[model samples]
Target chain A: MQAQTQRYSVLMVDDDPEDGVLVQKAIASSGPKVDFQFVASGAEVLDYLFTEGRFTDRSSAPRPNLILLDLNMPGVDGFSVLKQIKSDMDLRRIPVVVLTTSEAETDIVKSYDFGANTFITKPSSFSDMIEVMTSLKSYWFDAARLPTA
Target chain B: MLAIYEYLFGAASFVPHGYCLAWRPDLIAIHALSDGVIALSYFSIPIALILLLNKREDLAFKRTFGLFALFIFSCGVTHLTAMIMLWEPYYGAQGMVKAVTAMISVVTAISLWPLLPKVLALPGPGQLRKMNTQLAAEIAEKNAAQVNLHQAYQQVEAQVVERTRELQALNQRLQDDVRRRSLLEEELREKAAQLIATNAELERFAYIASHDLQEPLRKIQAFGDLLKSEYETVLPDEAVEYVRIMQNAAYRMNKQTKDILTLSRLSWDSIQFDSLDLAEVVEEVAFDLKERIEEAGGKLEVGPLPGIPGDRTQIRLLMQNLLVNAFKYREPDSIPEVHVEATLHDTGAPGTGGACVEISVRDNGIGFAQEDAERIFSIFQRLHGRSEFDGTGIGLAICKKIVENHNGAIEAVSSLGKGAVFNIRLPTSQPERREIHAGTDTAV
Candidate 1:
């Protein structure tokens, strides 16, 4: 749930630094209070989500309200991460958005099949990316209702 | 009896024939001359008979002729005896000669009587001549028949020789046909092997294009976009322009790789065909391109279309590329007008011909040169520079591949400066799907 005083959190898992930074900038531009977090690999995302390994301290690993996932990763790919998150009762309630460079139909269908809330192909232009971020923020933060964390 | 025997042997009757004529000179002379002439005549007749018998030795009655000769000689001896009797009265000798002649005459008569029927049975000269003529006629007829038989045999031999020659020629042609067919089979086998190798290579290329090649290009574009969006104010106008150019290059490369990937995928992907209304497909394509069309101030007119069997996604891409190409190549300061229409050609009444739908995409845009119609449907074949028309030059090639994927044909007809028409012929029914050999596992 969105509250005026509490800042919402978002987590993105991507292997590419360039894509991560661009999405970070877009998220920053879209919302001032959004706590956007970046994990470089699927393993790190799992670590951060379960509060294990380097993120073992409960205070350091804040549970995210939404997850932005990239399907192609070096090890423990986004599909496996998505499957694990959706199957876990504690993590299943969190919304997942699949964002990837691939515009392949198979990827889109598979992402939805794995219980992803939305699928977005990564826009090439900064302006288009900003638009996607703005609309995502408006829909998730302002229009649609979510269960309280 | 003793006195008679003595009288027969003794010369007591020895007397001259002249004394018997009473010693007259004229009478004696006449008797002697007549007897001498008669004797000479009788000897000459026997000699002539002997000569006749010797000359005609093949005569049928040779024994009869010998008997006749003997009888004549004996009679001659008797006549000579008479002549002697006229000179010297040797009556006993004369009687003996007459007796021998009488005996020979009696034997000749007996032999002649038995030979009479045989001599009568011998053919006459006229009958012999008639038989010779008949034999000659029969011989002539047999000779003519023999000649005819020989000619017929020759004609049959000639025909056999001719038929043998014809059979030999037919065998030669059949052997040549077999050899040609074997050569064709060998060529086909080699082509099949080459196709396998080429398909493998295409699959490798598609994997590289889809993932590895697009990766760095995407990064380059993303960073360039960031620089332009975030640091444009701090950067000089020239720097900003450089960034924009770099992004544009990266974008174009990405698009080119994507198109290459699509073309490669079309080659090896398994297609599942569905019964689709082509009108609905075209309408969907038009709706997706609505904003672009409105931006170009274009008008799209769709006519009635038939249902055909095709891959839905591929067909959608095919229509999208065609419409975009029509609008992209439009003349400056003119509204882009694209028309989509289809006509059914039910040629399946004859089983050899397939019923098909001929869909034509006509555009009132800047058409290409007539000679370049075939070249336009080849990948990366650009008709204009990038600045003149923003294109990767793979749209028509993709269209061609899509049409071919549906087991169809496509052709473009146009003149320079005239509107172009792209005619696509698609069968109403899909052909049986052939199983393609899977590529290497490493390929994406």
Candidate 2:
């Protein structure tokens, strides 16, 4: 079953390098074998999604199966990015999960309003991070079916 | 006798001379007409004077004018008799009338002499006209002055009316301003109430978040323990030490977060206040702290305590925190001795009539500096290192928060190397009677 399954790709958007590294480490430890990409800014996420500038080549910048979005960023913010992605016909079908440190109900509601597939609070400890990543991998890669590109 | 008779007869014969005097008709007619005209003029004058006097009863000197008229009439009557004699030649009658006229003439002359000065003093018509003109001028002047005075009075009345109108307008503006100010004040009060509610909501959110945050930390500690125990042989010594250190750090973090949660939850609105005896609360705390106290070789002396209005659970927590602190901060080589006592106090809060209970927990412990007395009640504040005293440093802060939840106050006074006393003051009854009544009435 594992050999027959197609490997999934995930684009992670976060400004904190340490958090990105921690996620990478946690996923490596407990998650499925999947491709991972990291972007530091919401602008970079948008550039990569639109295949603009340096990401003009479709083969080098393949569209990911899922997007892990962070809310607070220096510029272009998560809500704007989410709005852009959901409004566009080509990108609206791709699943976007909001992973943020905010436990505010407003943030959760707003994420759903922008067509976020999932909303999750970032775990504080490394072991909890690992557990959350394992659950996320299991649910997204193994249980749910993804749309073909 | 014959000679006397002859003489008398000769006297009768003497009138024969009158007969010899010529009987001229012209002379007789002229004399009669003259006398009649004189008499008529004199009598008419007196009648006119009388009539003038009667019409003008208020005329000055009326009696004098009457006497003057009567004298002139009497002179006219004498003339009337003389005219009668012209027709009848009755000498004796004529003579008698003449005598009466003479007497009237004499009286008139005498009276006229006395009244002459007064009659002359009477003003003439020309002089009276002059006086009338002067009086008329004086009256005209007075009328003009009165007109001017009336005009001035009217002007003053108009000014008063205008001033009253201005005052009324000003009063209206003042009322409007007052109304607007009151409205603004009411709106401000509403905004302040909203701000308070928002702050409370934020506090609740913080409490819940912190509580949820503890779960991941617990998991970390639990898994770290699992790794340490289960992989003891597989893990290297340094790796094992790192895991243990991570577990210790996670445990400390968990403790701090829990304290934060407690601090946040202290503001929860569901606390119930009831009348509680401090003696009972102290006894319970003593029993809870019995093992610790025995290990520290401490003795707790509880005196009589008064009943106070408070939340029972919070007050119990307050007593436990203070009692534990008393046992925890004991001086080395000195047996820990703590005294719990309560007395009636005057809180001086408005409307409560200063009825309160002051509970003091005193201990022979390693007291802090006087300046740090206030600092000790801040969360996580520590005077000594963790190795010196085992505490998260949130105990006193929790105590303070709990006491505050009951609308009470707590204070500590201590000097370095001396003992410390923690005093808690709580009202014996709710301070605001109206609020209590409202709460109870609405609660039902």
Candidate 3:
């Protein structure tokens, strides 16, 4: 995979720590090259991206090339994060894929309207999650062009 | 004694007056005729005066007229004595009569002096005529004023009648308005009752959806999948079966939670009504289920459908659910064949009369008994065993709710061997275009 030569880090934002672990496993099953990172809340996403608060270490907290966002969080929801990311010049280039358990039309449309690159319903099965991650990996890392870091 | 008697009787000592005239026949005759005519006129005048006095008893000074008549009678006796002396002297009797006439004339003259002023004070005929003319003019004016007053009374009467009629009309209109408002109020009361009952049901659904159950259920399914995928090589066959069972149970529970959320959303959110082409909706659903249909070797024939007023998302879901049911409940051997068709029909709903589109979805599937047709639309109601068919059993219930939100009707008909048919009726046009907000005020 091209991720071996160019290490790509993906950040996932969710309030549920278990969903973060499951997604990390799925990413591992998809490929060995891609690095997976996690944040527990939407507010922590900004901290990790801007190197603020607990994420002040420059070397430890790197800018992610992609962001996986969950819509139903306690505070600073996915929509507000998407809006802030899309509005910022430095963060707008990072592709955001909304992976939430909501299959609501309003959520999907709102996610896309807020400049989400993709909207995916979180699958229940581990195999389905692996399939989603594999396709996402092949599409974003292999097929699609991205801004050079 | 003889002298005294001759003075009283007169004519005994005197020769006749005819002798003094040398017995001239012409002179005698003239004196006698003149005196006789004068006496006759005086007597007739007294009689006429008496008759006048008797007829006019109301005349002023009646005693004066009687005295004047007596004086004239005495003068007539004197004249008769003159006529008698033309032949034989009657001088004594004439003197006595003259004395009586004098007395009566004096009395009449005295009475006339006082009565003259009273007779002059009486109104004359010309002045009375002028007064009568003035009285006639005043009476005419009074009559004209009476006529005007009568006309005014008539006008007032007409106005009263007109006002009464107007009030009656206004009262009738008010009565009609009251009846209409009462009917509307009755309908609102019924709707409020239904809302109360529906709100109670929605509360339960909301509780289930918001219970944080799906998260744990999803984790269970995902961990179960992970065990099978990662630890299958080390696990025994029995452990593998146990993992599979746990995954199936979790998957079913996850589906139930998702279905509950869908039901709660229907009761929590305001649905948007729009003009929707149902044929296009069916095409989209068929395209979405294309793989399933091809895998089953099924045929979905869509006939001409109608455009109806409904919530687009809900109507799309309705079509998807019905078609998915047809594909899901198919017999094992038979090729799944589903026909989608529509017809224009009248809803004939009271106060909501309009045309509706009747869409039927007939599927060659494992049909349920006729009795379970109505029960299938209930929430979480399932006729077949969970092992036989894969469903959370809320699809038909959602369909029924969607139809109700559109103010439409939906029904299902099926027998044991025969195929099942789902008929949905949607109004072509909404009556009295008011925005409808279904469910509770709070969003789930």
Candidate 4:
């Protein structure tokens, strides 16, 4: 209910730095007054999510309303992280979205199977990503009422 | 009495000695028989013609006409020879009669000459009549064709009128349609745009999902590790077992998810086509898997491989997977022996036939039930226990997909406890084949 008035915090984890920056640009361009956090790998997400190790300070590490993940990573990949996040009672309440460079059907099915709330392939061009983020703002921010757990 | 007796004796004694039908002495009888023979000889031409002309396809007129000509000529020969033989007859043997018969035959032979010209002439009576009939038929056909054309023209005129009206209506509709089409095209373009966007969106979603999911997966793996490492001491045996099982499942899922991503990427990724020597590829794979093969105490045998248009990196991966399977599924207490052979097989039409290279990899592995042969090519379909043989269960399926990308097929032949041989076929042709066809055609 609080998300109805207040802007939601988005936590995006991607191995590619350019992409992470691109997503940030897209969110900003959409004119949404939102908090954005970027983590390089899936391992960092755990520290951030559970408030453990480097993410011990809760104020600096805000509770994210949404999480975007990339399936491919060097160590402790995306699907494994998704399963664990969805399995936990506390973490399961937050909406998780999957982002990839491929429109592969298997990833879509698998991501959802692991309890991903939404799936989106990262657009190639800057403009397309901006457009998608604009529509996403229309849908997630305006159209649909997200669950409060 | 004496005169009557002399007349009777003279009449009785007038018959020539040894005069019989076999040696005919009577000129009238002989002449009559000669006339009959001449008549029959003359009729043979028509008889041969009748025989030949009975069936439509039996024989043509030219052959029968030729036979008729021969019959006339043969009859002339028969008559002339008969006249020469009959020159000195007993009862009515006369030179004049022979001369007359010879003359008739010579005249008849002359008649045969004109008949031949008539026979061999380009157009006979029948042919001329046939020509007339054909001309009439052709004229009728042409008239029919003209009528059809006229009807068609009338129909076309009607159609044009209707179509013109349709065009006017269509012109109005077309304007609407053009706008609609533009709108539809735009809608399609938008739909395509959205689909593509959604596709990209989906990919991003997967990436994000994978990225986000990894965090929790790592935590599961890590916490499972943490629990095992830190909390295993005080926990109950059942709890420890549950933690271990959880970790096992989590790790298994992690590996499997990663493998599934990899396998699916094989389709999504672009395949590079280059001339790859399969022998060289196999050798490289064999070298890479040398340690594994040696550990399994297995031997790798290779064959004369055909060079093909293929992706070298992918092919190397293909060979690696096959060899790995060979090494992984070896018989109990036996060294692994894997043989990789490639040979060209002929297929299709004539000298310009295409070539298919059959690459077979045989291994003395723990063979499967034959029914499971096809099942092995399915994703996540495993024949053996994870303890007995460890795999992502997508190795063969990936191999099949890779082989199929090259327009090839893969088949497995094996029996339980014996061994397994995997056969892969790729339809490949030589680059120089175009040159050969071009050269031969040029020579001709």
Best by DockQ: 3
- Which segments of candidate 4 are over 4 A away from where they belong? A1-149, B1-202, B205-210, B226-243, B348-353, B429-444
Cα TM-score of candidate 2 = 0.54
Going through the candidates in the order shown, the clash numbers are: 1, 0, 0, 44
Docking class of 3: acceptable
Q: What is the TM-score of each candidate against the true structure?
A: 0.64, 0.54, 0.65, 0.42
**For candidate 3, lDDT tens digit of each residue in A1-149?**
34445878899999889889899989998865687889989899988888999999977788898899998788798888999999999999999999987766667888899999999988888989999999998888877878886
lDDT of 1 by residue, A21-90 (tens): 8888888877556988899999999999999999999778889988999988988998999999999999
Residue A109's lDDT in candidate 2: 85
DockQ (Cα-based) per candidate? 0.21, 0.03, 0.31, 0.02
Per-residue lDDT over B361-395 for candidate 3, one digit per residue giving the tens place of the 0 to 100 score:
99988888989989999998988888888899898
Q: What is the DockQ of candidate 2?
A: 0.03
Stronger candidate by lDDT (3 vs 4): 3
- How much is the lDDT of residue B343 in candidate 1? 89
lDDT of 1 by residue, B202-287 (tens): 87777777777887887788778778777989999999998888889999998999888888887787777888888899999999
lDDT of each: 0.84, 0.78, 0.84, 0.72
* Runs of candidate 2 exceeding 4 Å displacement: A1-149, B1-42, B53-75, B86-190, B193-197, B225-245, B267-273, B345-356, B401-409, B425-444
| Clashing residue pairs in candidate 3 (N, C-alpha, C atoms within 3 angstroms) | none
Clash pairs, model 2 backbone: none
| Colliding pairs, model 1 | B15-B89
Q: Rank order by DockQ, top first?
A: 3, 1, 2, 4
